[model samples]
Target: MRKARLGVFKFTSCDGCQLSLLNLEEELLAVVDLFDVAYFREATDKPLRGTFDLALVEGSVSTERQKEEILNIRDRARYLIAMGACATSGGLQALRNWASLSAYKARVYPSPENVHALSTSTPVSDHVYVDYELWGCPVTRNALSEVLVSFILEKKPALRGYSVCMECKRHGIPCLLVSQGAPCLGPVTRAGCEALCPALGKPCYGCFGPKDDANVESLLSRFRLMGLRSEECRALLDKMNTYAYRKVQGENRS
Candidate 1:
């Protein structure tokens, strides 16, 4: 049988998600035996440039070039998966969506006019039909392996739904939210990291983005009840998936 063609693409991201594939290590060779990794320059210098059975894209559409690039990728890919917070919910850079781009460029860079970036950092879904999203700062190897095996079996990948709190409970970790009045996003942030931050005694920074049906407003209310200021609540929600979370009604965007 012919090998299934696979491609890995990157955009405006830190390349952490791409690293997840390489981290597969011994299992990575197993995947090589199953598929023809067509384009992943991060792994090899001789990446094939053509249509693929599956294409995993990392990073948000943050420029006109990337906007056009993703469309071409969508046209060529049989299945396209947005493989991290950057691609699915705009990543940490999405924070700029709330502030003035000019002001940010002026404050951060030495030459503001030389800075070339889109006004908004948006998810892949905003510009194209994303077949799936891995929803993480850097997608976990466990999920990547599961998705790969699912592709071979011709079954749907079991992603989406489930909260970080569930994973915390599963790991027998105590709830930081209840035990210490921590302003945690575990209840609203998507599960997959196995509640790593909470287990380490820090509140979830929403690195996986918002879970399905996540009640940002309710969480904010809970934060306020815990004596958190408005900015504090916004800051917590304003991490990797700021724009996506801000869309959750009942909270003020400004």
Candidate 2:
């Protein structure tokens, strides 16, 4: 059988998700054995020019050039998987979508016009079709490995759909919100990180994004009961997964 050719692409991001792939350590070698890494600028300087069997795309589309590049990659790759919070849901930079990019540029730079950028940071799916999405600030190595293995086996990757609360229960950790009145997004946030923050007695910061059918309204009401101001609750929901939360709010209002 011919070796599967893989390509890794990036846009506007911290490259943390690409780093996650490199951080696979032992599994990195295993992945290399399963597929030929035809293009990865972070790992090599070789010129990449061809279609690929699988392409792992990281980062959000934040510029016209990036949008063009993403479309080109999508056209060439047979399977395109969006990796990390940026590629999956526009990442932390999506915060600008809720605020004024002009004001931000004016405040931070001497000449705002010199900085060529788009008004909004959007996910990969906003530009082209994505076969799958791996959600995280920087996606977990275990989950990434599973995705790679599944692809090689021609099977669908089994990503968890439960909330962080389920992982907390499995780890036998006490609920930080109940015990210490801590603000937590665990009840609504996805269950991929194995309840890392809650296991250490802190609240889940929603790094893994919102779970399916998340009850944001109830969570907000609960937060308010625990003495969180409306503004504070809104701010918490406006973190990495702000777009998802906004969509939920829009749906509820409709």
Best by TM-score: 2
lDDT of 1 by residue, 91-169 (tens): 8888898789999999999989998899899999999998878988899998898888888899998875779999998
RMSD in angstroms between candidate 1 and the native structure over all alpha carbons: 1.9
Q: How high a TM-score does candidate 1 get?
A: 0.95
lDDT of each: 0.88, 0.88
Model 1 Cα shift for residue 112 (angstroms)? 2.7
Please give the RMSD to the true structure for each candidate, in Å.
1.9, 1.1
Candidate 2 vs. true structure, TM-score: 0.97
Error of 1 at 243 (Å): 1.9
lDDT of model number 2? 0.88
lDDT of 2 at 178: 84
Q: Candidate 2: where are CA atoms >4 Å away?
A: none
